[model samples]
Target: MQLVLTVLEIVSPVFILALIGFGWVKAGHEYRIEFVTRLAMTLSIPALIFVALVNAKIEPAALTSLLMAATVGFAAVTAVAFVAVKVFKLEIRTYLAPLIFGNTGNLGLPLAYFAFGDEGLSYAVVVFAVMALWSFTFGVYVTAGGGHPGKVIKEPLVGATLLGGLFLWQGWTLPTFAMNTLDLLGQIAIPVMLITLGVAMARLQVNSMGRAVALSLGKVILCAGIAAVVGQWFDLAPVPFAVLVVQLATPVAVTSYMLAEKYGAQAQEVAGLVVASTFLSVIYLPVLLGLLL
Candidate 1:
């Protein structure tokens, strides 16, 4: 009961309020939401990543585990998504982005922080960086069909990751003032993302709910199961391994909708997946935490 309550306390009100705000103001205004999401994707999120990775103290071995879990989960999901597209004859153009881009930032980061503290958060950051790269490049290609996927290489996150990598390689640290400023900017990224997500959710149609539910379950349950088995084999600690599993279990990212919109995939369908996964995450997250923690 206490665990259940804790989960509810942490997740529900934020989501509920965001839903209400979206319904009240932004449901019909997709453009407005898109503008804000772009700001996050292009600016605040990258800053957050830069600060997190540059400052994070990562063990070489731990980094290997983190990379392993991310790679395995990505491969598993990609294979499943391939099968999904083939079996359903899904318009190859439409389903590819959501099929690949699971919610790593919003749902995954928080759960990782809660479960394994800063170390888990670092791992989640690495996963987010990886997903962002793949989502922008291959995901765009899959969505655009005949267009140039090369444009994805120029995205801000890609540049930021390169810069951050330079810093990591050099063992560089930011000055106090610079670190503080980046942290301040980084803090805003998550809440803005959540509120925007709520706004996006307000626009979802009831008829689309079933498909979204199925997709969300596929991400959380199927992906998480694969992560757990692989993590155990790799001998990851229970907490960190569980953090990876839960991160896999997070909802489809709002970024999916944004990317789908930008690339001309089924944006509304992607949005529905984001909203549905988030709503269901309220239940699934706690259940997962109970079992894993």
Candidate 2:
């Protein structure tokens, strides 16, 4: 019961804010979801990631486990996606993005912080960083099919991660003014992401919902099951392993639709998957955590 409440309290505001955005659109507000997505990708998300990474304490041993988790987690999802595509004879672009893109940043980061505190969050930061890179690069490539994988290489978020890593490696600290600016911008990322997600969900047609649910279930349940078996085999600790599994089990990322839309790769399908997975995550996540934790 306590765990249920905790999960609800943490995730409910995001859903409610999404509903509010949906209402605005229903009321004929001229707000554009694409603009919000672009703003998040180019500005807010990079700022948040840069700030988090710059201040994050790095531990080689812990980072090793996180890297292991990330590598295994990503491979697991990709493999499952591949099998699903073959089995269902699905269109790769329309289905693959949701299967591979988990909500690592907006949802996973805070959940890690809540469950594991500073140390765990630091581990999550590394995993999140890698996942972000993967999402922007290979994930984009998959969504685009053959349209120029090079384009994904040039995304601002990719550049930001590189720059942030260089700064951390050199032990460089941003000036107070710059840090404050980044902090302010970072604060906008989560809310904007949630609202943009809501607006996008509002635009999804009812007909898309069934397909979305089927895809999301495959991504969450199947991928998480894979992670669980791998986690036990590798002997990951209960809390950290559970954190990793929960992170993996999160819905299709909101960014997947953005990338799909940008690349003209089954955008409606991707958007539907994002909405379906996010809504279902509210039920799935707590149950997964309850069993794992």
Candidate 3:
């Protein structure tokens, strides 16, 4: 009972904030998703990543292990997704990347902070960083049919990650005034992302929900199972282990839908995926937190 309550306490706010956005959209309010997402990605999220890493009391060895585990876990999941797509005769261009890469940023980071506090956020960021790096590079390549490697370094998320790691390694921080400013900017990221997620979901049109649900479920199971295996294999600590699994278990990102639309793939199919998977997460995430706790 207590554990269930704990999980509820952590998850309720996340869903509530999202529901606010959902309600806002339903009420005919004008929420510009692209502008908000652009702002969050370019400014807020990067700031959050930098500030979180700089302030986190994580050990280098643990960070290294989590990074390694995240890298391996994502690669393995991608391979499995590829095999499944082939066997199931699904379109590789539409489904593979969505299945392999979860929404570690918008959902994972905030959930970690709620579930396991700042320590978990620190751990979650490592996994998020890996996902960001992989998705920007390999995911872009897959989605776009071909992408430039140089584009990876040009991403602010990548730059923030690298800079954050450097600051972490050197035990350095910005002056108090600068740090506070960055922290304030970073604070906008989580709420903006959460609200944007809901707004995006509200706007999505699902063409094939049945297939989307089945494959999305498969993704959740495969990703969580694979992350668990990798976490155990790496001997990750309790918080880090839970963070790894939870991050991987998040729904298919909204970016997948946008990418599919932009690349002329099955955009409606990907939209179905984004909606079904996100809807599933509302029920599943709390259960996952219950178990993890």
Measured with C-alpha atoms, the lDDT of residue 203 in candidate 1 is 62
Off by over 4 Å in 2: 110-122, 166-171, 232-240, 258-268
Quick one: RMSD of model 1?
3.0
Alpha-carbon RMSD of each model: 3.0, 2.9, 0.8
The C-alpha lDDT values of all candidates are 0.72, 0.74, 0.91
**Can you tell me which runs of candidate 3 are displaced by over 4 Å?**
none
Candidate 2 lDDT over 175-234, as tens digits, reads 999999998997787777667667766776634588889778878888788778777766
- Model 1 whole-model lDDT (C-alpha atoms): 0.72
**Count of residue pairs whose backbone atoms collide, per candidate:** 0, 0, 0
lDDT score for residue 160 of model 3: 90
Clashing pairs in 3: none
Candidate 3, run of 10 with poorest lDDT: 147-156
Q: Give residue 54's error in model 2 in angstroms.
A: 1.9
TM-score of 2: 0.84
Using TM-score as the measure, name the better of candidate 2 and candidate 3: 3
Write the number of the candidate with greater lDDT, choosing between 2 and 3.
Answer: 3
At residue 58, candidate 3 shows an lDDT of 91
lDDT of 1 by residue, 53-114 (tens): 78767765676677777777777777877887789777667666676777787556655665
Give the poorly placed runs of model 1, Cα more than 4 Å off. Answer: 12-17, 20-31, 147-149, 262-264
TM-score of each: 0.84, 0.84, 0.98
On TM-score, the candidate that comes out on top is: 3
